[model samples]
Target: MTAVPQERRIVTAIPGPKSQELQARRLSTVAGGVGSVLPVFTARAGGGIIEDIDGNRMIDFGSGIAVTSVGASAEAVVRRASAQLADFTHTCFMVTPYEGYVEVCEALAELTPGDHAKKSALFNSGAEAVENAVKIARSYTKRQAVVVFDHGYHGRTNLTMALTSKNMPYKQGFGPFAPEVYRVPVAYGYRWPTGAENCGPEAAAQAIDQISKQIGAENVAAIIIEPVLGEGGFIEPAKGFLPAIVKFANDNGIVFVADEIQSGFCRTGQWFACEDEGIVPDLITTAKGIAGGLPLAAVTGRAEMMDSVHGGGLGGTYGGNPVACAGALGSIETMKELDLNAAAKKIESIMKTRLTAMQEKYDIIGDIRGRGAMIAIELVKDPVSKTPFPEAAGALAKACHAEGVLVLTCGTYGNVLRFLPPIVIGEDLLNEGLDVIEAAFAGI
Candidate 1:
């Protein structure tokens, strides 16, 4: 493995000769449905930089889609996972239990929002955690309908695709989706039909009203939403919207599930995004940043609700794999020692300052939203019309990449430039990356 210096050094063009050759091979072998944001093949990534095969280094604004909050190959995670790998790769927890899996669950219970008694079940990905959360919610509540908000993304499975609000590459031609899934209004401050000031109360009321009249609250199993929407742009639900919905769920006996996969584990300046707002969810699904880039996710919730599932119903063969569990434990230890929450807040401050300055200059930046290190700028044709400018977003991302800064663009309308820098990224490197973005904006 390369000991990549945590600095951007574009010695060659981004997808330099070596990567260009591999790109051609990838197109031939990899499926078309699976897409990549950056074309260059990564040699090593850590801290704030991704070193490509050709030795070109680029600042990592996307933390492997927010999976590596403690930095992609943090010493703790690698050390622990390596030890576990050498000991025994997998006995399968269902077949033979391991301490690491239980330990990961313990961390989840202690760390996830709500002071109530909580239990957790681990899985291989965010989607599995989400899908299992649905199963548990339905089992406990004996309800059929699952409600998700507009501009929210749950996962890619048939069921999650239904819960997810976006269409395009995610849901298009993938249905007939799982039934009993209802879509409601999200308090998207930027493009809310009702306007930003009224988005919170109005959207919450409409969502609650729709459930009451159409789905009937009694029929609802869960209301799953991302605290700060990811993939459908980084749309944070306006203040009061989440609390209102949680209240509705409480009144109706519907499970309040927060999909915190992208916003959990100190990525949002708190252990979890919901904690900042004091919005306690009955169930929370986590992945992404949970294990310092390992493929592990968990559904942590109230003890009784999680216990509702039959003994063998909630797990998969690789659920809480010993090595992943080790990684997660190590990841958690790193988070505590590093106080990555404070780092996340600092990232937010830097981003807020730079992006706010950019907004002052650029008419294309319609709105800036998100919390902690998970920030985004919604590009629009102009602030007046607020029409999505997906093309401009693409151009800006391209320019940043060429300048040795890896910026990611996402959104419902493909108009959001989301930055998920590692919490450990240094201030100097961070500012340098921002300079690239600012220059990109100036050129575009």
Candidate 2:
């Protein structure tokens, strides 16, 4: 049912002549800070393939940084959004209420973890949802300090920049951030100083100690974390880490916020990554894959915490646009019909098998971690020293791009190669993409 062919076919060089021209124009008009991992200009995308204007068909391993889980231009998503477009585009959900907006919130209430009576507020992006979750937590607990983890990426907004730990690109020169934000260590098993086995409890104890000694638990309004850290390199906290943190937050009066913006909506083989540990957050922030590529986000949480905010205190002009809500409904329908959660787990099984083989063959691969479709490999200069090999990551990605496979890189050290293939991708196309990566690794 997808219009684009699910195959990788290189007609010209990666950036072909047309893409080069577009890149030149883009540099002239776009801001300097904006960056592109692969510069091939896309003409159409569906299933698992991105067709460039130059007639090159490329396998989409990045999924537009995990935004197109249901695939770009899914039939149901396009159909529903088009029907909504025919009805109306925008009336500002705040000024004129609509059923679509309310329906999305209803879906979030049902889908998000937890059986307690829940409520949801819509937003236009993940950053807005996260910021609002912080506000709601503060209003509920009447506390000012917030705790975030090292290597976590919230967003580019000022406060989210504060929540984000990386410095070079996201937080460089953008200082004077919001006040009272605190950072703590996460349970990164591979890089844990002591050892991988001891990471779970040790990191949790260290984090709690820092909050108690440095900032005082009662003063903290919220403790936010990505169940599976995305931009900070697909790092899933070790076992016992999340439960311990959740217990600590409950013990203290801090609202626990799970930033599921990247790892939510079946991206991690589960409905949400927090469900892997059966951890229920007080407030859950979601976006990215919510509306089949439309700009829609949400903050769903306990009824009491959400209602704590004053009326009209949480809304935006374009939040929960009617068309986006339609897209979200259609997306959810597609996910259910296709059983993308099962597909994501299948992807994990295949990728782990292939990547594990590649790791055994190559010494540069230091670690293989992540769940379901959101998987990554950390490159290192040496296995024993474990020094990050960011250059190798960059090289491997570039090679994959040249061969018509779109790959992405991340990590605080810039040494992680992440693959987020569309959950609906064909098995043949998925294997072909991995083949490209294996070939690239061999060459590098």
Candidate 3:
């Protein structure tokens, strides 16, 4: 197979003739609700490049929303998944158990934090895994309430939309959402009223206080949070915040669920982000990077909690499709073989060095945060005021896209420009992408 060259080659204007034609066709056939960051349509993608239908190769900095960390066309993933697909595409685990499903669960049990005996249930999407985690937590604790944090993103399903913090794109017009879901404050350092240093302890105290007075701890089944928030702009809660919340959950017998869907599987320089704070959650939800772009997700937690749900209580027809399980196993293998964790750390070091330098030069860049390859720059109207400058972010992204660099903008205020470059990306390509970003900022 011809691998996609790790080079940026802009042969046509962003959405070139072919891509424009496809976009026109897509507008007529695809749902209006589905949005894309760039106007160009992809023809092939591999390594750190996405080749558009018009033959323009752009540097990939989004990783398909961090789902293709092991690379879109990892050799191991392709080999294993292809082999499994050739053998058989489906044999629903619920119908006739398969080794691949059991193997994936075993991997989750071993890889996820905590030494205690663990169990996992597979699903088809991040939202599904989160929904099931809540089910298990509620069943185990016999509670009716769940607590989440501000600026946290879980997923798009009804229950997840309720769990998610943003409104316009994710939760708008989707209510009435699931009941008994409460949102509390997060240790958002940049915008915290008290300042970044005090954000951790104060935010945790306030969040726990709200739970105690507003929603009785005894009634709360789970407190789910992204160790490093994803669509909520990759906000890693202030230090000590997660630990304090974990302690409160332990004290109250509530399940502490770390939703590591976006920050897990070595994306943050470690197998999981919670490990950075030495947090061992009672339950954890994972997806995205787990299956090398295949549709797979999982909820892994303490054995007793997972076993609390009665048999036949949880499952779906295509939950752990054998092919997806194979892909996940292969993805894990590739992660280990390539030592992608170290690669992610290197990317983090390079990005921080460059972004911090950019922050100094640009009054619009208010903050630079995130870990490993999952880094971001929050744009502001001006550093002195620190007012969110979403318009600047939009213009910057468009300029980069026009120059053959693919980036993504997120955050509740839509002012954060996030980068999730594949760990396998070469130093030269990574720096080139950053140069494009820097040039865009200069124009601002």
TM-scores for every predicted model = 0.98, 0.99, 0.99
**How accurate locally is residue 32 in candidate 3, as Cα lDDT from 0 to 100?**
99
True-structure RMSD, every candidate:
1.0, 0.8, 0.7
RMSD of 3: 0.7
The regions of model 2 sitting more than 4 angstroms off are none
Candidate 3 overall lDDT versus native: 0.94
224-305 per-residue lDDT for model 3 (tens digits):
9999999988898999999999999999999999999999999999999999999999999999999999999999999999
For model 2, name the residue pairs that clash. none
Worst-scoring 10-residue span by lDDT in model 1? 1-10
Per residue, candidate 1 scores C-alpha lDDT tens digits across 1-444 of 445598889889877999999999999999988999888999888888888899899899999999988888899999999999999999999999999999988888888877899999989999999999999999999988999888888899999988888888888998898998899888887777868889899989988998899989999999999999999899888889889999999998999999999999898899999886699999999999999998999999999999998889989899999999999999999999999999999999999999999999999999988889999999999899999999999999999989999989889999999999999999999999999899998897
Instruction: Give me the candidate number with maximum lDDT.
Output: 2
| lDDT, model 1 | 0.91
- Roughly what TM-score does model 3 have, to 2 decimal places? 0.99
Higher-ranked by TM-score: 1 or 2: 2
Point out the worst 10-residue segment of candidate 3 by lDDT: 379-388
lDDT of each: 0.91, 0.95, 0.94
lDDT of 1 at 5: 90
Angstrom error of the Cα, residue 65, model 1: value is 0.2
Ranking according to lDDT, highest score first: 2, 3, 1
TM-score result, candidate 1: 0.98
